[model samples]
Target: MSEISREILSVGDLNRAIASSLEERFDTVWVSGEISNFKAYDSGHWYFSLKDEEGQIRCVMFRGRNGQVGFMPQSGDLVEVAANLGFYVPRGDIQLTVQSMRRAGMGGLYEAFLKLKAKLAKEGLFDLQNKRPIPTHPRVIGIVTSPQAAALKDVLSTLARRAPHIPIVIYPTLVQGPDAPAGIISALKAAEKENAVDVLLLVRGGGSIEDLWAFNDEQLAYTIAQSPIPIVSGVGHETDVTIADFVADLRAPTPTGAAELAAPRRDQMLQELDAIMQALLQRVGQRVEREAQTLDQLALRLNHALPDPDRMREQISGWQKRLNQAWLVRVENWKRDQGYFQSQLEMLNPQRTLERGYAVILSKEEHAMHAVRNPKELNTKNAFEVRLAEGQVEVEFAKLGLLK
Candidate 1:
């Protein structure tokens, strides 16, 4: 018999064959396990392992697939993955090409969130009537957020741009994790206790459902509902919503949105003020024009009724006394009318108020009109203009009180 011939395969060929065979047999599968050794590369690819007590498997999720996952994946998370069983020809290793993934036990948390939300709604805690209106111009804006969070920077920058003169007070707290709920509650309480800020802003950056779970706490929701100061919640991105968001007086899509809602734009306010001043000037001019026409008509009638000097020459002495009395009466009436108009103009002058010991507080940057009805409205760091009768004085109030 002739020698039997057999084919020998190289390492590359073997790996390729195995990879092709695995792809053909197990097209798709569902696997449940705990995630571990998770790493995300700059290329946007995610590499991790799905492991059980007995075994483990390597997984690869490319940028396109993982980008749609919504929430960020982290190690130690239990998840169910839908993927294709595949083999890596280069490493000669078996791996999973993940198509999608979801938290293994998220349904229960979502159920709890819905239940608490429904309960609160039934109790009218989320009623529109109960929601307080945010002040158009808050004297002091209070912020409850993590001091180290990027959201704080966004909020501060927005507030500075829109209304730099407004004072801000920050109550720092943890925005996530197991202790975040308590920290938030405590911060709200402290802001109320201080009674400093006119409005409260509760804000944080975007995160996964688990990362935002602190805001969904039952106690935290109740605390927000019961807060004395009106709360503006800018908890996450536009699409992300939480229990606190529903309970807040107003909901802003972003931290910057919250700032915008809390204060009016300085430029817009100035334009409105200018329009009002122009309207007043136009009305005053019209009134003066009308009054002058009436005075001219009265003078014409008086001239027509006067006796002619040449015709009354013989009785000049007799008529002189009557003319003198009539002239005196007319001159006195004109003086009284002039005095009344002058008083009216003086009353409308702002300088009159300043002369009467009242000063106007104007913001240095935005020039926002502010009345210092309460001492708390003053901030030592902010500059202000105090317009008096003689001249304006720029001053900063470090501390304010009645002098002993």
Candidate 2:
């Protein structure tokens, strides 16, 4: 009680002590800020700093909890992060570890967009199974986009150059800003109602976050998921991604890519057709030549055979008579041999010694001769019956006693 002593700590120890104190005092919190200096690790962890106008804080988002954040936060993207104040124990540095996150737009509209996207993905509306395959040879390709958009020209020119035979039916609509969502949705509906094309190209030029908001609309995502015809989304540049990219059957990096993806290249298709045609022609020619060879062989044989037709007929008739006479002589010899065998068969008959279909009664023992008369060793009634080749008869002594 009289003396006071304090242990001098190094920077790490002091930082650990402060972090431990903060952890014990404060619970988890939610923060809103613009993301900057975001970097991901090879271990699939994200390290970033969240900054408001005045202050900034470091953050870490582990891969396991990363899904809680719907879309990736771009540099300078205003975001709402649900996090907890914690200490990085090894370094004893205080940091914000995030659990859930969402983009925070003006009035948090971007946050709402992320929430809706997460919900739709969980419902499997954006699954590959739901995506339709674009027709291999679409008779008509539909373009759902702003006619005024530069992307429209890119799409038309690409399709015209790639597949000149295929016609493009443009379904013009707004491609940016708030009203663009409804306009795009209605254009798709109109295309489906008319069954105007085999597949659709939903395209737009590159833009910033706010400018591309229409492409992230949940209703539009669902519409794409349910569209009967296949859709190829080519919104923004290759680096830009939208909700439509996941819902579409195919995602193109640019508007020109969408057009080229929706139809086949004319030169490649014609080359394939020509190859197949040549193969078919070769097969037909080979078959005709084979038939001609067979006809020639048959004609030569006919020429040789028809030269002495009368003599050939006479020779065939003579051979037929000789074959018949030889057959008659063989039949007579077979009849004579059959008669001799029949006589021998009649002489060996057991029935002839007794009567027609004869029967002989024997003792219970099969080897007992009929001439043996030891009745004491035999039972004639139920145990004994004589079987002939044709029939059987039971002899009754009315006794079943065994041989004594």
Candidate 3:
């Protein structure tokens, strides 16, 4: 055999050779173990030991790779890591540099789910204020899901049972696989554009987080939040919650539950209608009674205001009799006054006084002279006249005489 020429290798060279060999043998691997001695540095690097019942290996996740890990690794957490073997020359130790990690059974999809959830939550997408109120009784319930999905059947059955009269419009889309997210978003947009439905139900059957991964998409969650119509998410079983669940207006544990919440029961609505009808009837009856009572009161007032015909006639008769008596009394008093005035006139009449045997004497100037006491007072040469009641005579005063 030819003598093998050996070149001494430096520790750095040796470590590099081993690291290259390990990388070549296990460029990417899946390792399941419990985490131990985990430490996270301010630099965002993570160092831990992955231990099994048999043994444990040191691990390091650098800042870039660990940042993609949605959840922080804790000591004693059961996790699976996808990593490549690396050798440190200075320490002369072998360790794994993790590229990704997830909870054991969930796979890498779970990490993506968690990451998207945390991001949306931090941005306030999951806030209660952003959530809308589900319609109490949707006139039309819109469904966004694969037509072939069993969840669709479940929802339809539930809705029919609850609200048989409500109309339903289906906006069919893929509920799983890689194309599901885009399909879901398109369906949601289509439903909104139609503008017919009062509420939307985005539903899917129960499955692994991978099967429901489309619902966990950040864009899908945002679309649901920004939808003009209220959205009720029923993406999976009760225990499974997706990003869509947090951003939706309402969350239902199952597809059937979503249908139930979207509408009111027919029987219950009928009961309410009946109650309202009865109340309205009662109010109308009371109003009619009140109006009738008012009419009766008005009739009583009219009766009181009307005058009695018999009493009016009697009053008119009494007034006529009093008026006739007053007229007679006035006529009699006038006659009495006229008779008294006539008597006074007769007493003062000059012709009547002459008829009482009174004589009148006149002077020469044709003036009356009465009671001549001395005859000498008369002028003989003057003519004098004497008058009786019926005749007058003229004479001369021949002799003087005194008369009283």
Candidate 4:
């Protein structure tokens, strides 16, 4: 008998080859089942078994992938997951590595959501420029919701508490069921026609996708886009999104949130107004102070420019004193000069010489007298006169000779 030839394989190598074959043979696939024995480890990895009536599969969803699921899955949750098939080397077990997950039967709703969101976005209905700004101080707030709904009560209470002074108008309508979309649109139209409210709130409570589907209606989206007044949509919880949220001017998480957004708190607004007034008063005071300082500077300049009466008087008095002193000096000088000239004149006078007993002889001829200066001019026959200081005497020049 001949020995048969066989290839030997290790456990690790077989498991690796099996894992590779499984991954390569099957493309990414989606499977639906009820979750069982779901466990979330400290490492944020989820280990669970997905089972149908007749079969079950082990699945693992890493933290990185499950974080995008938006909600945690419990053991009984009916979910669909997109996964890749693989064989675990250490345990030699078949397993699925999950990439994404969502609640079962939500596929159609999600698809519709995406389609509508894309359509509206493409038409510019969700543009920031097209959206209106929510009023910070609304005088009148309008609500569009079911009168019997619990969400209406929450909105009313919030508005009453925050802005009691603001008047509230209720446009009651259906917020659920098949006719809710049309009812909401009619209410919006009514609010527009009345034009009484400064801002409008479209509010509803949180619910499943089916329960909140009315808000995603195409006509409702169009109505919201065409509304003249600003609309705030609070259709569901924070995690829930709808077409109305995209088309409205603003979106809130809850009905109370919508009320809070539409109406400003009275106390908060009062505080803001008071602060503004204080700032304005401060600015006015500063400006007035600056003007006052400028005025004072101008006044100082003017004071310097104008003549001071007291100073001018002092200057004038000094000038007058100096002028008087100069006049007195000139007068004394003139008097002194006059006295000296008078003395000189007195010395030149012949009367003083005559008064000193000196006499002058004159010759008289043809009824005129002449001084006899030479002996030849005075003849013996001619009459002569002797002049003295007091009087003149008649005489004859009998012997006019020089006596040395």
Candidate 5:
């Protein structure tokens, strides 16, 4: 053969080489960053990307290892994640394989949310008493619903068509995945924190239980209740209702209805205004029309007069005296009941029982004594006490025997 050389390694040898080289290069590096774009995949693996003010790298922690770190690291959490940088050949992506994760700084907002929610729920601020009533005709409207959601679009579209002049304020939030609860809690807090909005409309499109769980969060439900502002909850589709609905002052079957409830229709309002004006005019016209007839009737009435006097007052006094005598009879019957109660009390008195000659025996432990039926439960020389009607006596002996 001509001078030839082929550098060949088995697939295992290749994988091992790649793995060892990658592990060696990245082994001791510590990265500081905030967790973002986190995703836990099926197949018992976690897939996420970590980023700092600088940049981001996709990272994964296998199920068992990721589970050891306990609480999930949410997006926006500042974290110093420890991991080995490696490449997943199947996807050909160089990713950081995370080993452990912990919260850092403002990243702890999610943790703090859980803590406060637990505390407030324990104190019951989110209780039924704190809930406010939704306005029947809300003049100024506020929205706590997610601005990015399709449900928001549906709401806006419906409002524009049904009631255009009504103003809508949007509060943007994450409506799905791990970051959802904190995002929602933040939005709700922010709406109140800013303090200018009235009659908050909390709306969301319909989805499965998992898709809708963020609104079901007890903290969110409580936030809706504890809000100084009245809330109208519109979540999921028509059939969907969450704890937020129960805790909210009003529940809309759909987000569109929530918009309808919060915004008064221009057409309907004008109609009502017109009706009120008509009603006032009709009443005024009727009164003016009846004025002449009323004057005539008044003159006729003035032409005749009558009065009733002292005899009626005497009759009333006589009835009052009879009523007072009946009340006295009731008092005498109450006194007789007291005497009957005294007799019953005398019958139940313990001294009366003692006079009957029945006696009670007790153990030295002060428990009511039976016939020592369970000899196994007793000890030799156990003390026995006798409780007589007049007094008590104590005695001890080597063994207790029958009365005979």
Candidate 6:
């Protein structure tokens, strides 16, 4: 150019331009450094400076991004971060916006963990529909764990205390190191072959990620998924998760937890049984009372159906006097009249009705028998007596199937 011209720009404008250029010029990066001046605000944002022996840089990790970090970073902690280059226009300084972070040495292992978790999840290994129900009352419980493991002792004690009647079979195996996965598989196969236990427990105590790495093996996950008996996995502490935990039918927080889940407490089951028995007895009492009411009603109907015996006797006496007068007046006609009156008297007799399959139902109340005249006069709560031609029998209406 022949002539040079100077253009004035405001401080804010210059800073904004630089910030835009910095954001566009750099892609996301991985940085390794030691943390310094680490501060976590109430807003959940993290503000810190990452430094090495040569230089230091300002960094900010917002709440959304920082939550994914497994561990919180302290001032002296060495960290590896994946971040994007950014600039703070107000402060006129360059800074790194962290996307994810981890302890420096754990970066590779954490990455692998994430990769495997994602791959398994895509294959539907962790679906809720795939899980089998843990037995409420296992006849026999099988445990797969190291013989030397403290978890085994804890599980045994819990199962014995909760359900002493149930038997336990232990399949000892290695729970750590490179050989653990294969050993656990063998133990599981042995348990399957024996088929003595109703449910199986795969358990171990808590350990570091590296120490528990055997549980993360792909083959071990496949084995747990393929087991016919329901598997309850208790591999580590509550916070520690493994592939075995996901593949198992049920996951418990600890070995003792697994035992508690598999075995129903004897005392608790007895309490439930007692409650059911009481409820059934109460129902039976109610049913008996209702049946008595029905019988009382049927007895009242029978009372109404029968003619009064005293009234019949008085009518027979009057007829006998008439027959005696006719016999004296005409002796020849008296024989025929006598036969007709005898037949009439026999027809009116209560015993004749009883012999013809009729029964008088009486209500027994306060140790006394009373004629069941009306339903309101009888006590439905007491047993009823039926007077038949041959003998009297006491009965409850509910058992006779007459009401329903």
Worst 10 residues of 6 by lDDT: 364-373
- Per-residue lDDT of candidate 1, residues 1-404 (tens digit): 43456677899999999999999998689899999999999999999999999999999999999987877889998998899999999999999999998898766777888999999999988999999889987888999998888998999899888876676778889999999999999999999998999999999999877888998988998899899999999988987889999999999998878888997776676677557656865785676568557755655565577677444443554455575576568657756765675576456446687899988777543322344555666788888888887898889877668999
lDDT of 2 by residue, 1-404 (tens): 33456566888887788888888887889899988999878998999999987999899999999965546677798888788898887776679989888666533655676787799889997787777988898888888888678998888788868886675677778888779999999999998998968999999998766778898898899899889989999998887778888889999998888988888987787578557656865785676568657755655565577887566556555654674565567556655665665555444445554456555655444322232234575554345666666676656566456988
User: Judged by lDDT, which candidate is best?
Assistant: 4
Report model 5's TM-score to 2 decimal places.
0.43
- The candidate 5 region of ten consecutive residues with least summed lDDT is 364-373
Q: What is the C-alpha local distance difference test score of candidate 6?
A: 0.82
Cα lDDT tens digits, model 5, 1-404, are 33456667776677667867887876745677777787777777877778866788888889878776645667776676777888776555668877776555423544654565566667765576666766766545666655567888788788777766454556778887778878877888887986756778888888754577677676676666667888888988776656667668888999988888877776786678557656865785576558646755644554453233355445545755675676568557755765675566455444566568965444443222332434464555577765667887876647557896
Q: What is candidate 5's CA lDDT for residue 375?
A: 46
Model 1: residues with Cα > 4 Å off, grouped in runs = 1-31, 34-68, 72-78, 81-101, 279-404
Shift of residue 145 alpha carbon in model 1, Å: 1.4
Clashing pairs in 3: none
Candidate 1 displacement at residue 63 in angstroms: 11
Clash pairs detected, candidate 5: 77-107, 78-107, 206-236, 206-237
Q: What's model 1's TM-score?
A: 0.55
Q: What is the lDDT of candidate 5?
A: 0.69
Pitting candidate 1 against candidate 6, the one with the higher lDDT is: 1
- Cα lDDT tens digits, model 4, 1-404, are 33455666899999999999999999999999999999999999999999999999999999999998877899999999999999999999999999999899889888999999999999999999999989887878889988778998899889879876676778888999999999999999999998989899999998878889999999999999999999999988888899999999999988888888888776786577557656865785676568657755655665677678566556556755775676568657756765675566455456777899998887656443335556678677877788898998887656657999
Q: Is candidate 4 or candidate 5 better by TM-score?
A: 4
The total number of steric clashes, by the backbone 3 Å criterion, in model 1 comes to 0
**What does the lDDT come to for candidate 1?**
0.84
Go through the candidates in order and give the C-alpha RMSD of each one to the true structure: 12.1, 36.2, 51.9, 52.7, 26.2, 26.7
Question: Which candidate model has the greater TM-score, 2 or 3?
Answer: 2
